[model samples]
Target chain A: MNSVIFKKELKRNRKNTAIWTAIVVVFTALILSIFPSFSEMGEEMAKLMSSLPEEYAKALGMDEETWSSIIGYYGTYYGIYIILLIGIFTASTGATIIGKEERDGTAEFLLTRPISRGSIVWTKLMALGTLFIIIYGIQTLSAVIGLLIFGEDVNWPVFTTMHVHGFFLVGFFTASGVLMSSFLSSKLNYMGPVVGLIFGGYFLNAISMAVEKVSWLGYFSPYHYLNLTAKNGVLELNLITCLGASVVVAVFLWISNKRYLSRDIVG
Target chain B: MNAIELSSLSKFYGNQCGIESVSFAVKKGEIFGFIGPNGAGKSTTIRTLLGLLTATSGKAEILGMDTSNEGARIRERIGYLPSEVDYYSEMSSKELLLYHAAIYKVADAEKKIQELATYFQLELDRPIDDLSYGNKKKCAIIQSVLHDPEVLILDEPTGGLDPLMQNRFFELLERQNKKGVTIFFSSHVLSEIQRMCDRAAIIRDGKITAVEDISTLLSKQMKMVRLVTTSVNNIVLPVGALNHHQSGQKHTFDYVGPTQDLVIWLSSQSIIDVTLSEPDLERIFMNYYQS
Candidate 1:
């Protein structure tokens, strides 16, 4: 009921959110700074690509010939890593924002106010959603700046599409974190599930590349939707899959709210 | 109307124990003190009344509405302060109060926050992380009562305060009570309750062992008595009517029966000096705990 409380919660976490955004921006700048020099070293990378097996090339999201190109490097290497980084950071922050209060014995104070428990949970979720969007915006802006500085001939639509996919991935991961936080009381308890999901998804995607027969495994990971190499070097918008994942997030949120409202805050 | 009521209320945590078969009612304009030692279910009962925990059996009603069914409505009119007050350390006292004010839909929230900050002499700009424990407790107390709730439920509200702050806290409660707020506070500090509560329930091991007017509870349970005799020969006292210890030629007894009956019975003994004293809450509390 109290919308201002939601804004204040977002403000409370603003410092950490800004720190993460700055880290992402700095990392992007550092990666882009090395791009223009890659042209001079293209021959060396081509030789390295040639020495690799076909499965390795595909797993790395590269073709043997294009492995040396800056665009291919960004799309295949930096793009996946950046997406994963965003997902991991967002999920960790989102999951802890609400759960940490409980763990620290602060939930009692918050709940004793005239606000309803459902409203508190909803406000926290909204605050996390706002932080996720802000982080995504900062990352997208930093990428655009990096592309401009590197003097790359960028396709605006393609660039925007890639980030859109990243946005969905980040959102899904944030929801996953919130869902996990509802079940986990301590930060330590959350680490195992979170690390398992991120690394498990990446490894599953990698395994799908090595064994063609089990290539379907990639579809199970949110990382699969982050394939910027396909669709003519642009992100392919998978409406059905995105919607399915969104539905999953919604269901998780509903369960989290219901569970939170019903359970006694023992901490 | 009764401010709050619980009938056969019970709560359990898995296989562990919580409150069991607890029941009491607080009147609309009384300061009701819940006295108990640690883990005696005082907090559990308060949480159940606030609808923060579901009762495994029986019923709890607040403002004539079922606690579970109308918890939000009940919360809207009730102010609560938990035993341990924790807040977002990054937020300033002003920010925290404003946030609570918004959630509570307090009228003229900014003004209300300022008024509370001024009343408590709180530093509005200082971050919560930097404040001392007593200051943090003040912030929590101010936030809880800022909305001018109809009922106030405070758990150990003055746990960490200095004597001056504790006295000021009592003054604040008295002021609120004057404004017709129904106060239900839990404390292990007997003197605080003695000075503030109109009625009280002494709880032990999750049960309300005694619930009566504060004066009646103190008068009936607390006592001081002395007896003297010329001969210290074979002086034996009644078994169930009194609890006593003797020194040289004097005897002292404490009990919960009528003083006249005790006086008359003592008069029947050999003529000597005699003395009687009223009960103190500390002794009554110790007896309740031991029982």
Candidate 2:
């Protein structure tokens, strides 16, 4: 990979990355910091959970344990908001990272540079990975600090499993964004489609979980296989799902690189 | 060996033609011009040569390397100035130039960037989006040459420059040429071609009509003839004259043959005033178009 291009790409996305990272970390802290109040009223909150409609409760991944433990409480919101928020940022950024050059008429300047297209794509991907890690790392760190400050006898294994699943979920969404951008026109506004893809996947799983009649719909969403919430205060990472998703991400990146290499740099 | 060579290079957009069967060669250390009107496939050929667009057929070679296979290596040794200037809007000129230099791995890039910016009288601190079109063009020019490339491919390079900058640009080009840099200059302005190019190829409708030396194009015996006769009388037309026009006592036409024949014919007329001059490159270009 060309370091010059990689560095430039990273610098180009820095502001956007910062804005999204701030939002994610703040959201993480807000959710985690509020857990203390919820745990204090655990008995009353369990009664409230029972009073809620069973279908709606299942759809949202809320249960009796949700109010009893910080990890359980955070897991419900983490899947619903935190992972989705991070996914949206990464997916949208991934969509535009390469196509933005073509849309801005700067592809002529870049493609004519003394670097192979393979190197260009690889470097940009590296930049994308770096951005992903920065946002993801900071948000996770914020979660840990928030838990330390607000919780007692935290379920560390459940928390780790939920985060591992969150990693795969966000990664799959990011790769999907790269693949989608490769197939679409460079001039397209990709935010709409990127948001739709990530949210749509979540809702598919949610809807199938809430309705037993259409449980097969969950198969189509990556969230179904990569469980983002714990059951009975326990969550375990699925090795096969992680390995399969890695293969899919690799395929997606390969296809994106191939598409980029053959595209004409038209102004 | 030729500095640049195209062998029947063609580019087609689906079934539509961008350029077709175009072939030319630029000798080492020569200023070769590519002349064509707007939408005449000039940019298409240049883009194909730079490997921005894949050729439908045939091949291109630069400095003994095939462009399709060795584009990155070939680009390392070449500098290209596009007809339109489009750069990263958020970057200042200094940042953009530094980035470009970094891509090429140029040595002493900071000093070179400053020198070129001074020569162009450009403010390096201004963001690209805030700069005027001419200023952007200047920045483009600076980036194209900052690497001190062995070959320079320029397309409509002087569109936004003032007369003074244009002169400086030409002077710089001449200096580079003297240093054995091969320059491929593309423009629709025939005078620029006539003034700077040793040879030129005229393209029309995606095909090269003629490739001639500058001296040969000037020596074609084509002259714009205007005669103010003493009276309205029958004037014997020269055989080589074309597009003759008469308004009152004045008669004008393009004379394409021997100068002696035209002089003899002029002596026979009852002329009050007569003038003959070499036509501008526009008329010469039109002659090729018409032929």
Candidate 3:
């Protein structure tokens, strides 16, 4: 996968990795640390949640039966924050990795090198591709460590399902972000659109949950895939949803490579 | 066979023109100059050759390989220094050079990079963002030739360098040419082109107005003649010498036509010393632009 470019991308992205990893890991730990208090006051919390508007509770992913279990507790409380952080971390990084060369006027230096655009795009994708695995690794490790320090009786299968499903869910944005970058004629062209699309996908999930007429809007949001509270929070992922997300990721990545091959890189 | 060739290469950005049907060729082991003013398509032609921007319509070949399809292989033997240089801002000069070395798989790259660094007087350990414009230009020059490629494509390589550094760079280029490297030197600076190029192609408005040997290009258009005579009043003016100026015993002017007539006239005069040479490319460039 063009090891030279892969290593160069690694060096270019080291600081980004450090900043985002710290934000996600520390943020996840902080959320998990409150689990003991959540467990002690579970009944009062349920009453208070029920008294709140049903739409607000559902939009915020507050489910009483799901909250009774540790994994569901973690998923409902911490998953959204993790998703947003990763969505931003992946999308912004994906959008800018190739665009940076154009922005800094370094494309002339690089494009003249003895490498095809296919190799260039894929190597950059491969570099950002590792961040998905890394952030996932850090999340899994930090969540496990947090669970040990704050609670008991962890739901191992469900926790693994939530994170695994989360990866595919967030990967769609990452691929789309890269594809958007490939189509931009200028460095500043696609970044705002990418961030807007991410937030649009996020709020669509909330709006779809809040309004019955627009429930189908949830289909466009990665957060709604394999709904974490489904089937009594046992973490059973629908095979159809998994297959569909895979198709989307593959399509976006393929299109990104193809578009990058011919698109003029301008800044 | 030509080392580099372009036939009707055109690039249009939307309705605006970048270049239009530009064509030229450089012989093997030749130092070819490309001269034009800003926005006159010098960069567009070179960028097309390097495969950085695909041409709208044309055929381009380098080292017997098509630039459109075989860019990677063509670039393997080519070194390019762009008009304006920029790189990863956070990387030090040493780090950037090493990165290129690894990418190009350069042999004994450490020694080569160190040698160029010293030659350019570049502080290798300082971050690129901390370097001055001239220092960055030095880094660009060093990287372009560090691989010792068979061809060098330099665009305005001396923009930010002082006179001394520019002189050293010219010397470096001469050394490389002696080793049989084909060079395509592009500049808007006429004096540098006059000083360095063996052959030059004058491009304007996206077209090559003239491609001629430096000698023929200058001699056909104008020659600058300087002569020291005991009496300026005693000199007989040649048939087509223009803009005569005299200061004490010296007379200078732009001359055109046969050297035989000028020599006969010079032998008749009480001459002290005389020097005849091609004028700079500026007047020729102006003629091309105006016409």
Candidate 4:
């Protein structure tokens, strides 16, 4: 990877990365900070859970433990909003990191430099990975702090398992964003499509869980395979699914680099 | 070996032609011009040579290295100025030039950037997004040369510059050429080519129609002849005269033969007045373009 391009890409995306990380951190704190209130009235919370339809509660991955424990409550929203927020930031960034050069007509200048196209793509991907780690790592750290500050008897294993799943899920979404951008026009506004893709995957999993008649649809969404929601206040690491998603991510990045190398950079 | 060479190089967008079987050579330390109108495949051929567009077929080489595989290496020794200046708008001109210098690993880049910026009369601190087209072009010029490359590939390099900047640019190019740097200058403006190039290839409809020395092109014996003659119902025109016109004995035609033959023919005419003048490169270009 070319360090010049790598550093430049990172610097270019720093402001956006900071803004998104702030949003993710604030939301993490807000959600965890509110969990104590729910737990304070556990008896009433149990009744609230019972009045909700079983299918609806199941679809949201919420149970009695959701209010009784901090991990379960955060897990419920992690799949719905936390991961989606981080995924949208990372995925949209992945989509535009290399493509923005083309859309702005700066590819001509950059491509003419004494660097191979392969090196440029690889370097840009490295920068994207670094950005992904920054946002993801910060959000995870904030969650840890918030859990410590606001909860009692926190399930560390379940939280770790959920974050691991979060890592692969956001990674899969980010890779998908890169792959999608390579196939689309460089002039495209990638935010709409990137947001659509991440939100679409989450809703697909959500919808499949809400209705038994269409549960088979869960097989198609990455969210379905990489479960972000806990079961009975416990979440298990699906090593096989994570490994499989890792391979898919690798393949997506490989395809993106290949497409970038061979494509014409028109002015 | 030639500093730059193309062997039947072609680039086609599926069925549409960008440049077809385009071929030429520029010797080391020579200023070679690629002259063509806009969309005449001038930029396409340059893009293919620089590896910005994949060649559909054939080959290109710079300083004895094949462009297809050794593009990065070739680029290390070459500087390119695009027809349209498109740079990172977020960067100041200084930052962009430093970035370029870093990519090339040029030593003492900050000093060079300062010098070039001063030479071009550019304000280095302003963000590129705030710069006008002319200022951007100036920035582009500085970046192209800041690394002291062995070759310079310029496409319409004077587009946004005023006359003074254009002259300074030409002067800079001449100095670079003197330092054994080969230049591949591309322009649609005939006068610029005439002023700077030693030899030029004329391209039209995506193919090279002619490659000739600038001196030879200028000294082609083609002259625009206008003669106002006394009344004569019939007159025999010389063999090389073309596009003859007569308006009440005010005759005009382009003569392409020896001057002596034209003088002898004119001596026999019932002449009232006569004028013979050399055509500018623009007229000569039109001749080739139409042909």
Which candidate has the highest TM-score of all? Answer: 2
Clashes of each: 3, 0, 0, 0
Candidate 3 has a TM-score of: 0.90
* TM-scores for every predicted model: 0.87, 0.94, 0.90, 0.93
In model 3 chain A, where is the ten-residue run with the lowest total lDDT?
Answer: A226-235
For all predictions, the C-alpha RMSD in Å is 3.9, 2.5, 3.8, 2.8
What is candidate 1's CAPRI-style docking category based on DockQ? medium
Question: What is candidate 1's lDDT per residue for A1-267, written digit by digit as tens?
Answer: 467777777777888888888888888888777877865677887787778897887776776424344455566655457777777778887678778877777777777665778888888888888888888888888877888878456656656666666677777788888888888765455756776777788778877977799999998887776555544555566677678778888998898888788878764
What is residue B117's positional error in candidate 4, in angstroms?
Answer: 1.6
**Candidate 1 backbone collisions, by pair:** B222-B279, B223-B279, B224-B277
- Give the CA lDDT, 0 to 100, for residue A7 in model 4: 89
Residue-pair clashes, model 4: 0
Question: In model 4, what is the error at residue B212, expressed in angstroms?
Answer: 1.1
Model 4 interface DockQ:
0.86
lDDT of 2 by residue, A149-239 (tens): 9888889998888888889889999999999999999999999999999889999999999999999999999999999788877687798
Is candidate 3 or 4 superior in DockQ? Answer: 4
Lowest summed lDDT over 10 consecutive residues: which window, candidate 2 chain B? Answer: B282-291
Give each candidate's interface RMSD in Å: 1.6, 0.7, 1.4, 0.6
Candidate 3 segments exceeding 4 Å error: A189-191, B221-283, B286-291
User: What DockQ does every candidate get?
Assistant: 0.62, 0.83, 0.58, 0.86
Which stretches of candidate 1 lie above 4 Å from their native place? A65-70, A155-158, A187-192, A211-220, A231-235, B105-124, B223-243, B246-254, B257-291
